[model samples]
Target: MAMEASEIESLIRTGIPDAHVEITDLAGDGNHYAARVVAESFRGLPRVQQQRRVYEALGGRMGGVLHALQLTTAVPE
Candidate 1:
């Protein structure tokens, strides 16, 4: 099963209400995606932790239904 881009965005927003999330289907396939997430909550967090937050929002679909993701995270400017 492949995950939809909207689902990804929805999950991120659900997990981090204050986040600004952008999701792209890199391979034109729902299984592969790239997401850029910006949030005030990410401030002072390590890169790994920021990325972890996004991954957690996905509800453990990273290596199953979602397949692969190229993720970028940052604090709001």
Candidate 2:
């Protein structure tokens, strides 16, 4: 089954409590999604690491229940 946007957001928030997360359904099929995450905790992390953190938040759902996720990360200004 496809994941819900709220579930995605909740997972990220649970993992990164200080993060500001915005989720968009790219395909409207609940499979493809775009997520923009901003957090002070990401300040010194590399982009790949930042993305890893978000993926980790999803708890191994990336290639299973969640298929395509276009992710963007940024440090809070």
Candidate 3:
């Protein structure tokens, strides 16, 4: 089954409490998503680590139920 956008947002928020998360359904399919996450915690982290943090927030669902995610992370300006 495809994961809901709300579920993805909730997971990210739960993991990164201060994050500002925006999720988009790229293909109009529940399985594909594009997420833009902004967090103060990401300020000093490298891009890879920032992405990893978001992935970790998904709790191992990345290649399973969550299929594909186009993710972007940034620190608050």
Candidate 4:
């Protein structure tokens, strides 16, 4: 089953307390989502590390409840 958008957002927000997140359903299907996250925690991290951090925050929901996620992470200037 696909995960709730709020739950997904909550999980990410909880992991990165000061995150600015934007979630989009690319195919009008809940299974496919794109999340753009900006957080202070990613300040000095590499692009891969930043994205990985967000994935880790999901705690293994990536291929289960949460399906495909086109994720992007950035730090606010």
Give the total clashing residue pairs for model 1: 0
The TM-scores, one per candidate, come to 0.96, 0.98, 0.98, 0.92
Instruction: Tell me the alpha-carbon RMSD of every candidate.
Output: 0.6, 0.5, 0.5, 0.9
Residue lDDT tens for model 2, 15-41: 999999999999999999999999999
User: Given candidate 4, what's the lDDT at residue 38?
Assistant: 97
TM-score of candidate 3 against the unseen true structure: 0.98
Q: Check candidate 2 and list the clashing pairs.
A: none
Q: Model 3: per-residue lDDT, tens digit, 1-77? A: 99999999999999999999999999998999999999999998999999999999999999999999999999999
Q: Which is the better candidate, 1 or 4, if ranked by lDDT?
A: 1
Q: Which stretches of candidate 2 lie over 4 Å from their true place?
A: none
Q: Which residue pairs show backbone clashes in model 3?
A: none
Alpha-carbon deviation at 18 in model 4, angstroms? 1.2
Candidate 1 achieves a global lDDT of 0.93
User: Per-residue lDDT for 59 in model 4?
Assistant: 97
Q: Write the per-residue lDDT of candidate 4 for residues 36-76, one digit (tens) a residue.
A: 99998898889999998899889999988888999988889
